[model samples]
Target chain A: MKTITSTVMLASLFAVSANTSAATLDEVVGKGHVQCGVSQGLPGFSNFDDKGNWSGVDVDICRAIAAAIFNDSEAVKYTPLSSKERFTALQSGEIDVLSRNTTWTATRDTALGLNFAGVNYYDGQGFMVRKDLGVNSALELDGAAICTQTGTTTELNVADYFRSNDMAYTVVAYEKSDEVVAAYDSGRCDVYTTDQSGLYAQRIKLKDVSAHKVLPEVISKEPLGPVVRQGDDQWFNLVKWSLYCMINAEEMGITSQNIKSKMNGKDPAVKRLLGEEGAFGENLGVSPTWCGNIVAQVGNYGESFARHLSVDPLNISRGVNELWSKGGIQYAPPIR
Target chain B: MAKEESAGPPEVTTKPWNDPKVRSIFFQVVLLILVVLAGMYIFGNTADNLERQGIATGFSFFGTTAGFGIITHLIEYNEASSYGRAFAVGLLNTLLVAFCGIIAATILGVVIGISRLSKNWMVSRMAMVYIETFRNIPLLLQIFFWYFAVLRALPQPKNSVNFLDSIFINSRGIYMPSAIYEDGFSLVLWALGIAVVAVVVMTRWAHKRQDQTGQQFHTIYYSIALLIGLPLLAFTVTGFPLSWEIPALKGFNFAGGTVIIPEFVALWLSLSIYTASFIAEIVRAGIQAVSHGQTEAAHALGIKAGPTLQLVILPQALRVIIPPLSSQFLNLTKNSSLATAIAYPELVSVFTGTVLNQTGQAVEIISVTMAVYLSISLGISAMMNWYNAKMALVER
Candidate 1:
């Protein structure tokens, strides 16, 4: 009887440890797909089309990571998560990488046991109001009812903005971005505040998009990026370098169309980035042609921006997201 | 008592290992041990994983500043308040909706339930249609219909549908006049208190007098007169000390008066309407459970129809109704959590949704939210149980 009880206890211990012992890359490799957490639908970020295809800058990050690992951009499964559910989903290993439009903050980094891989998009909080409301600026929004998505840094930023101005306002927050837009469009709120890019994204969903205008005021800096669970250094480095590879490729004037011809080119930086020289891919434990795959499949950062945000409906200019050599703030460390 | 000789102890037919009582006890003990072991394993495993993930696990985060604004709060709340205060604000909002919903549902349910059994064919059919239309549809859809389809279709604040220039109904909310009291308000309050006490004493005296002399008193009429007359008299003497602050469109919304946010209105209306349908069926069943003979007997005694229902049938029917009615009340309270979908700022929406995200304390926040709902449900259950026992039939 004693021996039987001991055996049962040992078996149960194994079961407990089995659930918690995931090394994200190995698990992703074993499953043959990268599990990516993204937003429900933010037009230029991570949105699902009617054809069941997801496309955006954030979605491309996950695709880039998958391309680097499996050399197949489509080997990625997406889980659309709300802002309220995103952190828990990542912390519980429900997704290997959260490429949602998540702002990297100090408290989230240290306290939530998560690490920001790198900033994929630089953004700032701003407001959108009805052009008919005759409100030209955010400071004029005193006593205005504001609608925002809940469980975001936007709420805290708006609260601080109003309190410091000694203005009184009411916030009607919703859990989903769609609800916020619906509420704002129905006149439940006088002002809609979110990341400036998000405001533009959501504005397209409005009934009369021409009737609304985004305010000029940029309230706070929002460095949106991908996040991974803490304590997995290998997974963290892989994700970080995957994003850097895209930015580096953009800075080198390398386009997806030219990447095939550049395989035998002579430039040292191009050779190194395209995996012809050095042990960059071997160091990260991926294929030597990993960077080549990412550029060929998902394209460089500039290509993605032009494809998603800088085009027709969004019409966003690359004021700050341009490469560091091109008077914008985007900079990447050189890979030896 | 009859004297009897004590018999010796009964003999055991089999060994203790083969005895049924010993076997049952052994099995129960083993089952208990297994249950405890499983529970401990789950707890330990969760803790281990959480620690490894580096997610903070504690209630200390409650004291941290919440730094968020709520659309509506019964108590004072601001960005400066702690997460604990936010929890209370959410709890109070939930209770406000649940309490108002319970009262509204019960009144509407009792009316519709009786209407279904009315002698008039049209009234009974309409009530049946009402019950079927509402109960058959899902509650969330009803809430969306009311919130998005009905309320959202209303005009904005600038073109609010005004009622007498004192009350404004718009897509934002219903804004009405709020009373601003002067110094002599206390005198009016005292007078109102005295009137209530006098009415209670008069009711008891009337009951006792009727028991002794077999005569009835118009106690309700007297109580109403006292309640209204005393307050009005106090008001006149105090020179009409109350002034009204009517809401006017100041900026984006109406300001300077009591405003009811549309989220609350939408949630309350949907929950009450949905729960009332179920309650109507329960109430109808309860009334039918009372025999037709009881009504006949009351009529045979020359009692009027209203009096028959008030005095004879309802008193007995309540024994059946109260038990199920309590369950409906509990359901309404729990269903209020769905307010999160519509942004009502209730307990689950404000605390569990926002606070959990801000603090990243899912383990602690979720458990606290669950405990709060459990306690609220238990409190409702205990109150209903007490009332049920009081109204229960007493037999000698």
Candidate 2:
């Protein structure tokens, strides 16, 4: 029975790959929906609500791409994936784009045949401990039992941090983010470690949300972004530029509300981005209003981030994710 | 004249196509060829797809460092260990749980099975209730119930329930005093080994004497004395060289003692309880298959109920029990893969879940994992078959 199931799984895997010859863009058009992969449930980063709506920074990236191509932000189908299954789902063509809160790493980019379109959120690995544990800093977490999601760079990052500091710790890894959060919340682990943003997002799920605090130490750089299968330059560029267009729109202070007013503005960059100036969208095999559609539908990067993360429920500030002109490192190339 | 004519029979010739033997063999060969072709096609297409997808493929990733920590490992492993070493650690963890689960399940199953056969209505009904309740539920849900519901209800380390100040139970795990053997521990081990061998030889001699001279020797009493006394004597003579490392609440968790992680406890408990339910039914069926006349015959021969059960009924019931019991064992081992759902770091969780995701070598990792399971199952089946053959009824 095991043999039969594995054979069937492999057969289906091969069958999916047999259509790799069809361009990803063509396939998405034919299917009439962009299949976007996201985390099963990570609030403020691609979470599904009770009303069957998907929203978050990562989810918005996919929506922005859909808006750019189909001129409709709703023309996307979200596939929730666990950390372990995300890459496989993408490689098997189960998803055209993986917009999960996945960290961009060298091993994944080169070895796993994946490409990082661009960083949507700049993050860093951190620890969250119960306030009563009496540990204020990550340094005090020696000999601690840490819970983390499996198949993510957090595992390796935690190992490196503890080893370099000559500390002893134990890891209790779960395949899904919810399981890790549950284990940590149940007091099965002394510390919960992941991206700092994830710590905040998962903190909301705990029974006593105010009783936990994320540590101050940022162990590793985690540039969370969307990913696409390598080798399709056109699809890659479309996803990449979709994110770039949002950042550029935010940089030029052109948001969903003011995009129409600034469509005929004198600034060459603004005019070009708003589809009033050049053939920028045509080069990417999309309509002239590709950038305009993205801004009008999904809003600019700042607007999306503020709507999903920086506002009431999550309240995460745009610390390192703000535009470069605002002293943050988020920089995008000129549209002209 | 009729008898003489009957001496000559008509010559017969048959076509090979019409022959059943030839036809069966020919069809089998064609089937074999088709199967081989299918296997090759699957492999060839997978290779082509892998290349086209630009995913790296090879076994060299095993030698690379696996920078991840494990919660519980029987073998020595650190984050610095290679992926191969991590694989070994995961495999050892799997074997440990399977071995411990089998023992616990068999013991609990036998007790429950016997209880179901008890003359007491309450005892029989309670056993029936347990079997039905556990067997009807899915094993994964039972595992979650144990891990997330039961174990999760335990207190944290600071509020751990201490047993005699030596063992501690908490949400973290059960922490017990681990033995630290110093010099001269080997002498105690040697004494124990010798005692075991002596007891075996003495039991054989006692059996022979009972058969030939109609005399019984107290082998059990002597065996117990030899086994315990010899080891105790060695320990005392060696100046009591063993020390215990007791666990105590330190910064966050208990330190300096052997701790059984909660994941292992949950998995082991769930697997044992779930499998024992099925095994209990199997044992009940085996015991019931033995005829009631055997008990009556033993009673007529002036044997007590205890002796009748030990000598007559059980030995016969085992003949029915051994075959199906092996299947339950295999099921338990395979079901341990569900450990991946929780964080047990078993083969599936560590090697397939983590390693495969990190390396993106799904084909190699999954194939190795499946092969490992297959081998373990085959090994259990072989051992059970040998034991079944030995216990078979020997007829003169």
Candidate 3:
């Protein structure tokens, strides 16, 4: 009896320990696909199309990382998560990477046991109001009822904005983004607040699409990017540099269409980026042409922006999202 | 003979390992050790994982600022409060909704349950329809129906529908008159407490009188009068210490009166209505479990149908009712966690959802949230146990 009980106990303990191991670069590759956490549905950020294809800025980041690892963008799985479950999913090894539109906060960096890869989209918190309300600025929203998604930095930012301005407003919060829009569209709230890009993408879903205007005042900095669990430097560097390579490709005018032709350029920066002159890809534990794979599969950051947000569907201008060499704040460190 | 018995004890029947009693003891000791080892392994693994991930693993996050606003709170709260304060607000809101839901469900359940068993065809069929309609539908869908479909269809605050001169209805919420307590309100409240104690003593005396003299006092009427009369008398003596602040539409919302947010209304209504359907069935089963001969015997005496139910049937039926009713209460409290879906800011939505995100202490925050629900369930069971003891069919 004693031996039987001891054996059972040992077996159960092993069962638990087997599942508690954290994410590692080797584990992701061995699994044959990357597990990426994303939102349930957020237009132009990380949402599925009518044909069940994932296409958004955040989704592209996941694809780029997949391309870097497997050289096939389709070698990826998506786990749609709420804001509440996003971090836990990464921390518990349920996902290899959380490519959700998560902001990189100081506390999240130092305390959350997570590392943000890099900023794929630089957004600021802003408010959207009906044009009929005659509110063009957030300061004019003194007594307005606001709607926002819960479990987000936008909720706290709106609270701080109202308190600092001594405004008295009620908030009607919801868990899903569509619910927030539904509430606002139904006149349950006078204002809707989120990241500025979110405002631009979500405005089209309103009852009268052209009747709403985003307020002029940007409240707080919200640098949205992908995130991963801490303690895996190899995985962290792989995801971070994957995003950086996209930005670098854009800055160097290397489109997926032109990447193969540009690989023969004499510029040392271009040569090193394409893995012709250096072991940068080897340093990150991928194939020598990993940058080329990402570029060829998912295109550069500028292309993703144009395809998802800046073109026909969501015509959000690239104000602060442009590269530093241009007039915007998007700057990536040099490869060499 | 005694020497034989002692010598037989010394002679082992079998090896100690194979002996039944010895082996039982050995197995129990092994089980205890195994449980301890398993618990330690889990704890150590969790600690190691938390340390490696850089996530803080403690309750210290409760002391920091919450930096968020709740839609409704029973207690005072603000963005400046700590996460601890936010948790308290959430708990209070949960308790408020749970208590209200239980009271409403009990009243509705008993009424429908007694009516379901009615001999009248129309009454029974209507009760069955109500029960099946609510019980068959999913609760989350019912909540969404109330919130998104029913309440959101109301006109905006600027064009609110007036219920009366004192109350207003709008898309924001239902607004009504607010009661304001003045300086002498505590005196009236004390008078009401005194009246309650007096009524209890009077009830015991009346029971003894009936036992001895075979005569009944009008106790129900007497108790009601005493409970209401004393408070009103005190109010008159203290110069009417109650006032009203009637709701009127101001610039944006009705500012000075009490407002019930749409989330609370939807959650409370859906929970009470859905749980009432199940509770109605429980009530009917309890009534059916009692032998009909008991009621026939009461009717054969001088008792009417109303007195028969009040004096004989309900007391016997309570033994079956209390246990299941307690379970339903626990279910309601746990289901209150669904408040997160509608943004009600109950304990789960506020503490586990928002605070967990802000602090990034999923391990600690989740542990605390689970403990809260566990304690609530245990507390309800403890109270039910006491009631069950009182209702037990005691005999010598």
Candidate 4:
């Protein structure tokens, strides 16, 4: 043992830990795929179906990113992460972009060495209570026991809301979202609290869909969006504009079906956005047709919103999620 | 002396490996170098990685306000408390669960261990069944079953099952009447302390007198009386200063009483019951290690069955039991980390999960948590080792 150890020690003296730079865009292209981090499962956001196929609003962001880079929506891999592991995974460069429904908080963006590209879904914390409880608003939830998963923005949001409102509440926090749902379903707690969109999505999993009501009050702003690691500005811009391109396209009457017709349009904003007028994509280190690929492959923001969230299974109304042109806050910069 | 000189001179033609002194010195030097190098490399690696990431690699976060509310804490805590205080609350809660679990398990274990060796057929078989049922199943599942399935099946606050109008049981938790000590309670505590000291002095005198005069005294009965009677007397003299604050049903949960949260109950119950199974096995083996001949010999010497078992068999059996029993205690303490699974807000659940996520200081938080658990395990073993030494047999 002594001889073997000495030999290994002698050998390790010459070994080196080679350092690699954080060039996420080049790395993704070199690997021929974009590694995207997403939530474990949140319907209309990052849910996995029975066939192991991933879909939702967050998944569309990942696909748009892949199309922007590789011109193919399928050139992407999904890594499901929990709330606790999402930040570390991004920081360690294990995934290019965290496309989970992570809230863009000041601490997360600045302190945690992360950068929130842009808001994909504007939301806020809301409460879901049993209709039989007759709690119409959060003010009526005094002395209530709230059920929420720990280690997320929802827990802290509800905590802050209750403290500020001078209401006493007992929080029954579970580690898993499903556990929180089960606990709430089992009547272990009186109210279930999470993001407004999440409450709508998770309400479908409850025991009785019609028996619970989501209160109208939004207690905290939770601008859920994709996250990228800090110090990678080029990669940040790619992720930021990928979502922006979709939003701007939605404002420009663009959709996945009509993207081909608008490819050679005469409009300057339309031409520049579709790569016919300028070298914007070249400046961002991708091809000139990056926005076009994103629009053609992943659809516009409104299409994704209606498909995954608003009109279908999730049925979440686009409240703050609607385009700014339509009185919502989802405004993106013009392609010019 | 002559034979030794001859043997030494004859072994002059020796190899380095053949010499015990040289081999040990060489191995020690190699191991020391390896250990130091490994430690330095790890520290350097961590420092480098932290610096590169621009993370504040210090313990300054401990002093900052945590800005979070913990649901279960022994110490007074709020959102305004420092991170260090939050950590203290978590540590205290962990110790609370572990301490209660150890005491309960020890009592339950000894009873069941002895019952397993009972003369009646049903008692022994029942003990066997219990041990098998608990030890084979996973503890995490047991905690969840008790917490989610069984405990949640109880009634709500308005419909709570009341026990004599002092306690309330519901899905939320079990609320019992808490003692509200009024002023002048310290006098009662002083009386209890004095009574304990007197009992100790009496036990010593009894032991010495038995040694010198060969006469036995009712030391156990006297001690029990002094312990209970003095406390009661002090209470009566003080005009029942301790008042019972009965639980009252409020809007959602019962207020005013000391409500043990269902998470605490589930974690405590699961840990105690699960650990008691292993403890029962250890205790049974310890008793079995004491040969049957010892008990038979004591019986033949005119000692009663209870005294024979207690004085003769138990002392000997304990020597075999202490080592494994101490390990089981440590195991129970470490298993308290499973509190995270059921969200009891113990050390790991609160500190490692919430604090780490909030501060985004994974490296510092994880190492500190590890150090805490390590110290707890080491501390338990040290105390038990001292106990084992005390219980050890004296020999010339």
DockQ, every prediction: 0.41, 0.55, 0.41, 0.33
- Whole-model lDDT per candidate: 0.89, 0.89, 0.85, 0.84
Candidates 1 and 3 compared by TM-score, better number: 1
Better of 2 and 4 by lDDT: 2
Model 3 pairs whose backbones collide = A113-B53
Q: Clashing residue pairs in candidate 4, if any?
A: none
Q: Write the per-residue lDDT of candidate 4 for residues A1-336, one digit (tens) a residue.
A: 112222322332222112125477888888999999998889999999999899999999999999999999888899987676677667666678999999988778777767899999988999999888877889988888888876798878887888898888887777778888888888778899999888988988987899999999999889999998777789989999999999999999978899888877788999988998889999889999999999888899999988899765578888878888898999998888
TM-score (chain B only), all candidates: 0.94, 0.95, 0.94, 0.93
The full ranking of all candidates by DockQ, starting with the best, is: 2, 1, 3, 4
Question: Candidate 3's residue-wise lDDT over B1-396, tens digit each?
Answer: 345546787664566776677889999999999999989978787777677557787888889999999888888899999999999998899888998999998999999988899889999999999999999998888888888886668988878888767788888888888999999999999999999999999999999999999998889999999999999999999999899999866656677688898889999999999999999999999989999999889988979989888889889898999999999999888888777777787988788778878987766766677778889889889988999999988988
Candidate 1 docks at the CAPRI level of acceptable
Per-residue lDDT of model 3, residues A68-163, tens digit only:
989998898999987877876776676888988898899888898889988988989998888887776788777778998878999899999999
Error of 4 at A213 (Å): 1.2
C-alpha RMSD between model 4 and the true structure:
4.7
Q: Native contacts recovered by candidate 1, as a share?
A: 0.63
Give the 10-residue window scoring lowest on summed lDDT in candidate 2 chain B. Answer: B1-10
lDDT of 1 by residue, A1-336 (tens): 112222333343343245356677888999999999999999989999999899999999999999999999999999998898788777766688999999999989988889999999999999999999898888899899999988999999999999999999999988889989998998888899999999999999999999999999999999999999898888999999999999999999888989988889999999999999999999898999999999999999999999999987999999888888999999989878
Candidate 4 lands at a TM-score of: 0.92
What tens-digit string does per-residue lDDT give for candidate 2 at A149-195?
A: 87888898999999999988889998778889888988889899999
| Fnat for every candidate | 0.63, 0.61, 0.56, 0.34
Off by over 4 Å in 4: A1-20, B1-27, B209-215
Per-residue alpha-carbon lDDT of candidate 1 for residues B323-349, written as tens digits (9 for 90 to 100): 999999999998898888788999888
Give candidate 2 regions above 4 Å deviation: A1-12, B1-19
Candidate with the larger DockQ of 1 and 3: 1
